[model samples]
Target: MPPNTTSLIQPLDQGIIRTAKAHYRTQVMRKMLQAINDGTSIINYAKSIDILKALYMLKRAWFLVSPATIENCFRKAGFPVIDKTSNVNEMQMVLDVSEFGEAIQEEDFEAFVDCDKEAECFGNLTDDEICDSVKLNRQGMADLEEEDEEEAGISYESIPGVSHKDALMHLSMVRKYLEENFTEYNSYYDIEEMIEKNALINRTQSKITDFFK
Candidate 1:
């Protein structure tokens, strides 16, 4: 009984496994890491989509997620996000922080994604309840079917400035902007070549737009 380190670690390890929600969190974090490694240059932005989508999915799927810890874990994993300064800034609570080194893998990123999706389409209700929720209208049925098709993939609709189509366009524009302005930012941007060739929105625009959005 001299310190009981094993006893302490056991609780920590057990807690992580016994809690269903925690398992989900770890899964979502891992998925986000994978998304970041896709070589988009603006990987921080991609990682942001991964985290926010996971958060939304967690709540939607009826598994309560800890926002503070979730934000902390993302930062620890090396993806930068500009989260809220205080509680008053509820809107800025969820942010993407990757402005540093290469991103790290989130432990449970995928589960959170699934949770959000299921919540959006099926919700916490029983099968009958979800079905009833859908049967209420023609549009609902169509939406439900469409959701099924999209649920298995990443959720980008809920994220601002993250649409695949828009992101591609932005990358092109950002690259052109960089070519015109590369000499201006050589000293400041670590990835000047990437900035000149991949980023769509400028830093000011990316930060400001995301801040307000």
Candidate 2:
């Protein structure tokens, strides 16, 4: 695989990755709104999310990626669909820019949908601006590292938004369902452990690799 050939050959680049990102973003917004509605300070939830809860939400989004969509992506990438097309209705991600006006105050969501002539003709960045951008990115990564440490230190009993008991119950249900349906998956792993180590949810490994084998 060449450096930039993924966009041309990867099925996930066709739409599956975009779908997952959109769903994840939507879930984040929904959780933010729910916290606000519950009169809890959204800052706490936004700042330090429970790692297990975050993984569970991401898994939900991953499962929302339909078999048909996956097959369609494979076909678009010049492969055959492994199984028959899924009859299940696909998830329609509808984002109303107007609805998000208050949620994101900086710019309208539609503004980012397309790059205008003005955007394309923007002058090159100054040396100072480039340095600032690099610094900002470094700071962002540092912040993420700090957050990861915080999440690692906390246990189920200390989670903020949802109770530990509820989180445990949800995980129990998910484990039972997966065990019944996916008998080959032979691990009664903790949700916290999975998220911490980035086990089955690693996105760097492409499904396309399996197709070629």
Candidate 3:
């Protein structure tokens, strides 16, 4: 790549990367907000996120990027991309970061996303540093295995399960709230349909279990 031309020619730099970062930031913010609501410290909640969880979050963020966004990114990067009709509503990509209100300013959010832009990922490590890192990783894996074993000893029946009726009632409240507060937003119907489908599947499974009993 030529000097200073990467941004102009790279499809990711055009919009895809920014969109992914936005999605990821929104997810992080949601988690933080949930922590606050649950009376947990944000720092502690953030610290609880391990590499595996971060990978899962990144996977979800990438999956949320629409095909139309990709095509537009390529087109903006000087690529000859054909315009295709996408079922995905572009407005859905616009994140409601405003939910954080004064807690997170627009500039601070942008800074957080771009903070890693110039970060160096690959570097030569000293022999001592490599050995120390290996030891730390091994200890971390052992700790995780121990925790998993302890969790495995707990019976499934010991965990409380939500009833289908209660789940549907919660969804009803959500649907009602959205309908009243966000009259212009129509995607909540899709979410409601998806939840209802899951509830139906759960009810079918329960009936099967009863028949077996």
Candidate 4:
């Protein structure tokens, strides 16, 4: 790769990384919206996103990156391609600016994706900093658990779990609403199947608990 030519020739730089970032940002925005809906402070919700939650979000974001997007990225990077159908629009749809209303603009999304363009993945660390990082990694799990517990003490409010029966009722209501409103209601079958599987698992667990009691 020539100097500053990586953006032109690199498959990742072409679209893959941008798509993943857009998906991740969409997830973050949705969570922020949920926090607002639930009356939680945005700062508190942001702080609550630990490494584990972030990893899960990133995992989903990468999983959502279509194979077509990867192929499009390679094609854009000067690679030979058979299918001429560009999946750029598919990537663009991943971050729906309309879904966020006036709170987020198209320019804001573009800026967010490009903000870390010049960021270095690896950086030089001082000897003390390196040693501290090693120490932190060695005891990371225990330290994290203690920190979470302390944080939970200050901010966590326990919400009661929904009963299986109530969950089933709500699921049925959703199914009914979709069936009545949508001509293409076949998608509800997948959701219904998932709920049924979960209900079965819960019932089995309840039986085992009853046996022990």
Give the number of the best model, judged by lDDT.
Answer: 4
**Each model's C-alpha lDDT?**
0.47, 0.64, 0.77, 0.82
Writing each residue's lDDT as its tens digit, candidate 2 over 148-210 gives: 668798654566775555666787888888878886644557564655355445445669778
Model 2 CA deviation exceeding 4 Å by range: 82-213
Candidate 1's TM-score? 0.21
Write one digit per residue (lDDT tens) for candidate 1, span 1-213.
233344332322222222335444444554555555665344564445654686775664334334544454444445466974423222122222232224432323333323543342222568987787677876876786589568756554654665545655676676678778776645334444455555455434446667776
All-Cα superposition RMSD per candidate: 19.6, 14.3, 6.5, 5.1
- Model 3 regions lying over 4 Å from their true place: 1-9, 48-60, 63-68, 83-99, 120-139, 148-166, 184-192, 195-213
- How many residue pairs clash (N, CA or C atoms closer than 3 angstroms) in each of the candidate models, in the order given? 22, 0, 0, 0
Candidate order by decreasing lDDT: 4, 3, 2, 1
Best by TM-score: 4
In model 1, where do residues sit more than 4 Å from their true spots? 1-18, 40-134, 137-141, 144-213
Q: Which candidate would rank higher by lDDT, 1 or 2?
A: 2
TM-score of each: 0.21, 0.44, 0.57, 0.67
**Candidate scoring better on lDDT of 3 and 4:** 4
- 1 or 3, greater by lDDT: 3
**TM-score winner between candidates 1 and 4:** 4
Q: Which is the winner by TM-score between candidate 3 and candidate 4?
A: 4
Better of 1 and 3 by TM-score: 3
What is candidate 2's CA lDDT for residue 131? 100
